[model samples]
Target: MIPPDNQIYIIIFSTIFLGGLMSTFVVAMVFIHRQRQAQSRQKMDQMQVEFEKTLRHVENEIHQETLTQIGRDLHDNIGQLLSLTKLNLNSSKPEKHLEARECVNEAIKEVRALSKTLNLDWVESLSLDEYIAQQLQRIQATGFCETSLQSDRSFAELKKEEKLVLIRVVQECLNNAIKHAQPDRIAIRISKNGRARHIEIEDNGQGFDTSKQSNGSGMYNLSKRMETIGGKFSLSSAVGKGTLVNLELPFSV
Candidate 1:
């Protein structure tokens, strides 16, 4: 056990063993790091898939809402008009006959226009800015308010999912402005802020305290939709001041 030659061999063997242990530990650390990275990438991919699926679900909901609106218009407004036309056609006077024909023609035109909206694919074909403008036009047509749109489409066209969620958010904002705010004028501005897209909808309507729900104007739903999309939504208003809605979304999902 006290041989000098053997002692030297023992020392050499210990050094080699220590070196191997260090190498194994280093390799283990690297493996752990790589495993964590893989898991993170998988999580992100899964989230993206889920986000897209949610967008499709929301799109279907919007389509259904549109269908309900069309149904009500047909049953209430168009149905009444058609009934009047029928009654006028049975009248003895020739003047009433001419008026009946005009009424029937008007109802036919409205039905044809509504038929176009019955198709779901029509929404996907429209650009984001175009869709927003159409919504604002509908509000203006109601004569409750005057609305304007200003958008910079040259910045970057949004992806389909991004546009879908954001459109609903914008719609909610517009409806809130009309119902709760009751503003005579509404201005919507859309532009880019660095990599984020900015949308501001300001109205001169009567303002209410944000702490209150404001008669359940669907503010919660708007905020939730924005959160789902990883976007920011903020509102500012007072008792006398008008309401301003600010929404910011990243360029890509």
Candidate 2:
């Protein structure tokens, strides 16, 4: 109903307004997308930092343990050889000489045992199950626990880093029970279900509330370690029901 000139002006204004709105929407979306990408990158960087820290800590501890083991082996095995040699020098009879030679052979046998016991190459190459069994055997020698292991041998499939973390977790937990809980009995059971491996360490000791009681760094470290590897950890305990630690690790599809 209006003049042709006015109608043209109205059309022009409408077109400009629509164009401005579309442009603004696109700019806003672009900004949001960039922000999201930056946040994701920051999260990834943080995780990497944490993982590296854990790896370094584990490596340091392993190095220290290896040194201690080697020292013990030398002192217990090779040191005895030196002692026997000195003892033989004190005796001059033919029978004494033969006995000294026999002692040397025994010492040589012990050196072989040392080589078998201190083999770190197996630690690096073995499966998780094998590593764990070896550890438990060492622990069991203390008459501390009725430990048992059942596995699909999938542990060897784990990366070296993963196996190290897992080993540390088990060692820490067992140590805590022995040092603090004074538990009379302990049991460890491991198994794999499909792509996930499960661990249950139960102790019949004086239990505490994991939420209220302060476990200091050990408990916190255990939880954080599991989380880093796409794993879950749970602790359940009562005043007298004892403590049970459960862990689960899931693999990427």
Which run of 10 residues does model 2 get worst, by summed lDDT?
114-123
RMSD of each: 3.3, 3.1
lDDT for each residue of candidate 2 in 173-211, tens digit (9 for 90 to 100): 877877867787777777778878788888898887766
- The CA lDDT at 245 in model 2 is 92
lDDT of each: 0.82, 0.78
Off by over 4 Å in 1: 1-7, 154-156, 211-224, 227-230, 250-253
Report the lDDT of model 1 for residue 67.
Answer: 92
